[model samples]
Target: MLRRQARERREFLYRKSLEDKRNAIQDKKDKLKRALDENKIIPTELRKDALYLQSQLEFDDKGAEGVTTYIDDEYKWVGVDDPKIMVTTSHDPSSKLKQFAKEMKLMFPNSQRLNRGNHEMKALIAACRANDVTDFIVLHEHRGQPDGMIISHLPYGPTAYFNLSNVVMRHDIPEVGTMSEAYPHLIFHNFSSRLGGRVKTILKSLFPVPKEDSKRVVTFANQDDFVSFRHHVYKKPDRKTVELTEVGPRFELKLYEIKLGTLDQADSADTEWRLHPYMNTAKKRKFL
Candidate 1:
């Protein structure tokens, strides 16, 4: 099993490298095609290969124009299969953290919470893989306050690390009602940038498709790089009016890092992106 996993990882990395090359070429082709269509000068860098690209463009069809990337492979089964998520807390978790993990489990349909009682990270991840878990989430806390989250996609990964803040669990909400178990509709706001799109894809894949009439809704609204999470259920009184009720367990997440490999490979895996809070313009720039 170990050998097979290692071989598969190598193959995945090889395909990802090829995908990068294809994306670069596709970008150049798009630029050349645009310049020609607008009757403008071809870019100096593309001039030498303009004829070659133009000839290749003739074979391009709308159906085959979309270039597939490694990301597509990672989430190929997203819509087809309801994701199987395994949620766990850090070792020796506090009672509050455990409660938070339980709330998280309830948030994602088809998810289960596991007690991380003295279990190693590698063993936990191995068990998840063997059980065909689609994603592994580890919740962390600082002095009993849930403060961090790590989301790792299985088989292979592009793990994302997030800092949690202002968490309000279910029981904490006044007069909170029973939680809905139906798959919830998702709302993503202000995820416009390239990195924002990548983050959106990771977060979006966590939920299964909801029915049109599903009353439950989950929202991730981004502003100045902090993503605020909200859960709600709505009811329509009159044809023109709708009433919304807030479900419990709302929080804010700030993405701080993303890795190209799973948690176990963190030591050697390439870092895709990381927050640089010490930069001169960090306070002025908004990533998402």
Candidate 2:
């Protein structure tokens, strides 16, 4: 009798466990269904409003065709003729700068910007400008010093200077005022001091310079300059290898730290420009 009772108790425990698992699965399915329904319903009204608003906006714009108003000054269009270069600088094949450049070109198809310029960028810029170049779209990040001694494998055309340290120091902004405040000291620590050492090591390993030490001193620049050097001067670190390290200015950091859930009407370039945080979400966040 005791054995039969024990057997019945065991059977009851097994059935209870099975029932709990079945209920849990059912609960999950119900939750998913509810979530899907909620998503579908929430977007439906928003979609209708957006479509109607967009059509109304189009009609308004069409109605004001060829009528120049005072408001037109605030909405000046960036003419499609600017010569811009889309630079992607990094050791990584899939860097954010590269992706941003690709997307930017897609969005503004008329910009005349290349990845990197050959030889002295200043010289190139001067030449391009003399030939009626109005604008340049370069990676703002590449405006600084690069990793290693040799800025790039590109050749410097005589008076061309490769090192951006010279330019950086010449900037009117103080260290405290610049983006250097946010990053660690490891970036610019040995930059000025070890410039000679780094250049020697890079040249010995990468390219065999025909000129003396003085010539080499003038040749070393930042990453983009280095890549340009390789392209125009040296022949070692191929076009694929040369890269700009930093992204855009730290202003993005300042803007990103704002905890506002909704943007104000005055906070944007246009009312038509909806805030799609997808790109921000896609970017790798260094800070929490």
Candidate 3:
């Protein structure tokens, strides 16, 4: 009799808990309905229509979808190998973009080559994720413009670049003294001819004008010079604070010239300059 009574008591508690949950959910639904009804009762047709003499506001038609909160799948593209350089001819790219791609292809000739297609890209991305591949190169062709700008979108939305190091470096590079001082004139060129509107938009958003302007230009140089420059940018400083070090007198170096482009293709000239005096002012160790 005691065991049977205990079972009944447990069953009663379980039913009561479920009933409580149902009541709470119903209460929330009722509250939402009430608020919705309150909003609905206000008739827009009854509102006064007044024409006040306000200053004319000009709005640019640049397409902007209001802030979106996107949901993404759990899978990530982390272990992909470094992207290989692939190339295709484009009439749309600027001269700079074509030249850059040609150079990259020479360096990585065997990298996979494929035509540009959204479906193909999506499939490739899925394959890359499944195969633990984080890096691969796609050479897209444009009319006469260089594809450099198209490269920007490879790390967008659901296709987020899992590599934070590049992101951080890209963010921090312009702030370093050399690039920082001349930063005002830095105009980022879509050196690759395959730029798409989506890629262009993403780049513009990240390095917004009158703010984080990317003015650095990529010039072709001997492999040695390129290697040296990369080392300077990526290298870690040796010592933090050493006693009586034979250090050269500190003078900020503006490593690169900065420039800007106008909307018109004809007047799109690079002609801006600035100098950073704080390039290497920090005595802190590179690692630190």
Better of 2 and 3 by TM-score: 3
Q: The CA-based lDDT of model 1 is what?
A: 0.91
What lDDT tens digits, residue by residue, belong to model 3 across residues 28-50?
Answer: 44444444568753223322311
Residue 229 of model 2: what lDDT?
22
**Runs in model 1 with CA error above 4 Å?**
279-284
Candidate that would win on lDDT: 1
lDDT, residue 34, candidate 2: 54
Clashing pairs in 1: none
Per-candidate TM-scores read 0.94, 0.20, 0.22
Whole-model Cα lDDT of every candidate shown, in order? 0.91, 0.30, 0.29
Sequence-dependent TM-score of model 3: 0.22
- Using TM-score as the measure, which candidate wins? 1
Candidate 2's C-alpha runs over 4 A off are: 1-94, 140-288
